[model samples]
Every structure is written in C-alpha cells, then in structure tokens.
Target: AEIGQVDGLLQDFPANNQAFRDANFDIEQLRKDIDQSE
Candidate 1:
C-alpha cells in the first residue's frame, strides 16, 4: 500500500530526474531489507 504510493510518486518525476533515480534505488534497498527481515 505505502509502496504503491511511493511508486506513483516516483512515476510523477521525469525519467531523467536524478532525485527520482536515487529515490528508486533507496526504495529498492528498503524493499530488500524488508524482505530480509521477514
């Protein structure tokens, strides 16, 4: 649910946007950590 909202926000940025890329990377890492925790 929260991840979906974050993905939607990421989509709102242009493909070339650096911040969006960084955020995507961070989100990917976060997902990995969450999966590992479970």
Candidate 2:
C-alpha cells in the first residue's frame, strides 16, 4: 500500500510541477503588468 501510494505520487508529480510552473508564470506576468502600469 505504501509503495502504491508512492507510485501514485510519482504519477502526479508532473502535473503538479506543471501547475506550479504555470502559477509562477502568471505571477511574473502580473508583476510585469503592475510595473508597466506604475
């Protein structure tokens, strides 16, 4: 069961990583827009 849980986490890692990257990109874009507005 523990091994299965680890495998499940491994399978989810890529999606989680992608989401994190997308969030960071959105944050960066928002910062840039705010800077431009200032």
Candidate 3:
C-alpha cells in the first residue's frame, strides 16, 4: 500500500535524522580532541 510505504518512510526519517546528528556530534568531538592534543 502506498500509504503504508509513506508511513514507513516517515517513521524512518527521524531515525535517520538522529543518526546524522549523532555522527556530526561525534565528528565535532573528535575534532576538538585532536585540537586539544595539538
């Protein structure tokens, strides 16, 4: 069903967003750590 597919996509959107945010945050933390070490 198209509606079911749409709902599934919507549900996945937040998870994807969170994953991206987490990755960005981790990268930022690593940058800070490296800067501190230098």
Candidate 4:
C-alpha cells in the first residue's frame, strides 16, 4: 500500500497502529525502499 494510504488506515484504526509499530514496520524506510525499487 502507499505510505499515505497505510498511514491513514493506522490513524483510523488505533489497534492496528500499535500492532504495526510492534511488528517493526518502518513506514518511512519502506517508502524509501519502494521509491528506489521503482
């Protein structure tokens, strides 16, 4: 998913936000990686 898309989802779902952080999902880094891949 796009960075903004996921970020919005997290904002709308607090529990998911916590789980995302707990899982070590680095959104910024993932965005950078995706950018470079493209």
TM-score of each: 0.56, 0.93, 0.77, 0.35
**Candidate 1 off by > 4 Å:** 1-16
Q: Which candidate gets the maximum lDDT versus the true structure?
A: 2
Q: Give the least accurate 10-residue stretch of model 2, judged by summed lDDT.
A: 1-10
* Model 4 whole-model lDDT (C-alpha atoms): 0.83
**Which consecutive 10 residues in model 4 have the weakest lDDT in total?**
16-25
Error of 4 at 6 (Å): 30
Clashes of 3: 0
For 1-38, candidate 3 gives per-residue lDDT tens digits of 69999999999999999999999999999999999999
Candidate 4 residue runs with Cα over 4 Å from true position: 1-25
Candidate 2, residues 1-38: lDDT per residue as tens digits?
Answer: 69999999999999999999999999999999999999
Candidate 2 has an lDDT of: 0.99
| Whole-model lDDT values for every prediction | 0.88, 0.99, 0.98, 0.83
RMSD of each: 11.6, 1.1, 1.7, 12.2
Candidate 1 per-residue C-alpha lDDT over 1-38 given as tens digits, one digit per residue, 9 for 90 to 100 = 69999898779767659878899999999999999999
